[model samples]
Target chain A: MRIFDPHIHMTSRTTDDYEAMHAAGVRAVVEPSFWLGQPRTSPQSFTDYFDALLGWEPFRAAQYGIAHHCTLALNPKEANDPRCTPVLAELPRYLLKDQVVAVGEIGYDSMTPAEDAALEAQLQLAADHGLPALVHTPHRDKLQGLRRTVQMVRACALDPERVLLDHLNETTVREAKDSGAWLGFSVYPDTKMDEARMVEVLRAYGPEKVLVNSAADWGRSDPLKTAKVGEAMLRSGFGEDDVDLVLWRNPVAFYAQSGRLRLDTPAAGATFEGNSILRGTPGAPDVPAPVGS
Target chain B: MTTVPARHDTPADTGAPGLPPGLDGPARAWLADALTEAARAAQAEADPGGTWQIRFAEAGRRCGPGHADAARVELLAAARPGVADLTALYRQGTAAERRAVLLALGRLEPAAAEGLALVEDALRTNDTSLVAAALGPYAAAHLPAHAWRHGVLKCLFTGVPVAAVAGLSARARGDGELGRMLRAYAAERTAAGRPVPHDLTRVLALTEEP
Candidate 1:
């Protein structure tokens, strides 16, 4: 019942979420640095956030027995901000770090020229770093975004096998499969695919290099979605081996291309980056201690 | 529906260099690489920033927890750097690297004062990893009893598992100051309706037994 969710944003999540995910059999997670709910003004903000992801977040996840890895990138949304473009230059040093398994959440938020440049540059960075690429297809006009994304990836020097086109749907899964790239889907509450629909995708597509994620982040999502999908596959009569392929093995194979997907470390201590999730409450009125003082 | 079979390689555990005995070859190779990388980073510059430490951790992640612990030791063995040099790495490192530096300080020659200052700095942070790391063997051997006892309570206050304190039982066995702090801390937690750390009671009992 071990699970490895290939895409999740743990920075936006609490330590409670890590405990729940680990309890639900999520042994590992890859938290690609994506857009926060609010826009970041400068590259320095992204730098601090990346430091936490590579440094603090892994420590956090390890506290709950989950292995945390990350993908480094100037997300498509921020790529459009002229002020944030400096992030692309800042990304090289981050890409050199071992925990960064891919260059990702890159592709298009609005299909702007800026996004195109960022995506192209990152694809090269991925090649340079010898890591994989996780491309986030545009939420709007997804069908068109998926097609354009696959085409742009094809033009890059990286092999198609190294590209993971994520946030895909029924409309684009077939084309993504045909593109000779790894296919990904983020099951969500109201948008994208759901548990039952994901089962359908599995039945029709047969789980060849397809990775499913929760995309759980600063939004309405569930950290346990990958496990839920595994349960759905079981209920729908998929064998344990088939379920393992999508839920665990597929992601391991993809990230291992970077030679960096070591998923065995149990969450080590109870604290993250040496910080524990617990805090003492400042008493309402000074009761002057519980009298054992 | 068309299908193309993809091969998923189950990541295997390799032993780190200078790890405890009975580990496999791959693990030794893995740890060896980690130690080498960490040493390289520590020597790369007066400051390599977080890059080398990050790389060391990447290698550390590839192995088991036991060997991972050893990798930190091996890093110092491989680096052979002075305490001043190691302290600089700690200051410039991210939490992961600092933890490694903290782990290696006990083995470093001269037991540098700079190393203890780094430990004190880590204790000041809300970061549980630093606090837990700061309480390792080096701190137990070097940090004053008063500061060391406070380090124990810092673990309790932060909910950092008391198990991470490198030498807990021997250290807290008969320390009166720590006992007092634990009682006060527990009382405060209770008055606030907090769960009071589960280990505080065990540690409290340990102190009272003698």
Candidate 2:
């Protein structure tokens, strides 16, 4: 079964993950920018992170025949820092790149004023460019943050379907779906829903407007949780098509609305455009005939 | 093994002067044929098992830029027993590109000298963060040489850097003749204040002897 893990953080994973994903029939994945294991001190860290998400990550995935895509954003946990403004400034350039699919994992954490400001700024950026957003609800007081996110998206006049309110559980899923926004569940190892519990949620929710992801990062998360969810769905008597819709089609349809999810098949024997995001500088010209031929 | 005939054309000018006098035509052709087979094999086998064989063959060819080129005469200097051309390739390529090649090479030839040189060059950069990156693969390969030298001039006026020569020396790490040459070069570098150029720290650090 072809699968698309809609929200995996592959930067924390190794080449083995790519190989295993390929072997497991995972054809593609979406990596949303998130707070790294520690705080980044400068804008360069964000730039490097974006580069890895779009650059090295894709190349690594390609070795195992898996396609890699990413979302561009200034993560919520990092927004409160005074050093984050410059990084926020650099977001537009990355968003314009062909592989960036959404302006997200961006939203409120702790319902702080700084979180509100960062969320509004990115919301405006997303609106200005006509992109979708992937919102991250806070782990504590999640319902309050989820409500705030819904209100802010409405105030900004963003299409409800264009927003993906992620990290939902029993408390926030109904409100997230009631607002006409797409609902996302991150299947974590212990704290979040396990496979059996996720099956129960799917049974309750009936799979409409729902997406499941691993949200696997530098934490105690599994990179293959989405696959596990897929397995659980099949065991729960969901048809293969229904399973594909939630894990693959739903994400592709939602993120594609951002107008940046490119699916170009690289030409056979086509050489890299010297400025391959994976190799050379972003705007640098291809190696110029060895500096004068 | 079925040997294919060597492709013959005018010896291309590789910025080196005339071919070394008295070099046998048939032996050169044979080496070129073997190297060509190795290069072809490397390109075909992306798995970890065939990496060193690919590197040895590619180094023998001495192609430019990409390892998948026709063997040039310059490759001969690096084809000697202990040479590690794969490391030089990693140094010359961009970081992301190099990481892919290095990862594949590390897996296929983890214990080969090709793996060692790649790690050694990564260490020589003198950047602590990058040293661990280089050593990660080096340690994975699990082959340690007593000592290594980086900067010995191969041909007069050519001044091929230590990284280039070490690729050859790496292949001969277990041989008596090559071992003596490597130790003496290591001694000379130690006597001088400078470490061998082209990043010999990873290689030297593996040594127990002074």
Interface DockQ of each model: 0.01, 0.01
After superposition, the stretches of candidate 1 with alpha carbons farther than 4 Å from their true spots are A266-274, A280-293, B1-210
TM-score of chain A of each: 0.93, 0.89
Model 1 chain A: lowest-lDDT 10 consecutive positions: A284-293
* TM-score of decoy 1: 0.56
- Report the CA-based lDDT of candidate 1 relative to the real structure: 0.77
Give a tens-digit lDDT track for model 2, residues A73-102. 988867766666578889988888888888
lDDT of 1 by residue, B17-44 (tens): 3665544556555556656666676566
In candidate 2 chain B, what residue range of length 10 has the lowest lDDT sum? Answer: B149-158
> Which docking category, incorrect, acceptable, medium or high, applies to candidate 1?
incorrect
Measured by TM-score, the strongest candidate is 1
What does candidate 2's lDDT look like per residue over B63-121, in tens digits?
Answer: 22332222322232222222244445454554433443443443345445456545544
For model 2 chain A, the run of ten residues with the poorest summed lDDT: A284-293
Query: Alpha-carbon error at A282 in model 1, in Å?
Result: 17
